[model samples]
Target: MDDIKAMSFETAMKELEAVVGKLEKGDVPLEESIGLYERGAALRAHCDDKLRAAEEKVAKIALGPDGQPSGLTPVDGL
Candidate 1:
């Protein structure tokens, strides 16, 4: 299994999609399905965090007096 913490947002999202597909098919054994569900949940949370962080960074960009983007602030812990 890959380290969820180290996985890129795109990678996590793709894996989560795959997990949903398998669960939707309803052909997986109960135990395996549970594992997949857990992993999917983690992936979902990670993706959400990544997206939220990105949104924050975008929002933090310095705007000029004319309301145009001037520059970006360094996002902490991103």
Candidate 2:
């Protein structure tokens, strides 16, 4: 779980994709398949959290004078 907490978005996505591939292959035993399913669920949650955080940052952004939003700013008190 700590490893998952430390995983980056790309890393999580890659692992999730690999898990899908393994599941699709249908060669894993029932027990291993269950374990992989749980791991995939955790990875999905982590990826979703990262996406939500990014979306919140996007939503807080203010448009600049040039009519384009400025780059992400650190959330106050974060």
Index of the highest-TM-score prediction: 2
* Clash pairs, model 2 backbone: none
**Per-residue error (Å), model 1, residue 51:** 0.5
Residue lDDT tens for model 1, 1-78: 459989899999999999999999999999999999999999999999899878998877998899899998776765
Off by over 4 Å in 1: 72-78
Global lDDT scores for all candidate models? 0.91, 0.92
- RMSD, every candidate, angstroms: 3.1, 3.1
lDDT, model 2: 0.92
Give candidate 1's whole-model lDDT: 0.91
- What value does the lDDT take at residue 66 in candidate 2? 100
lDDT for 26 in candidate 1 is 100
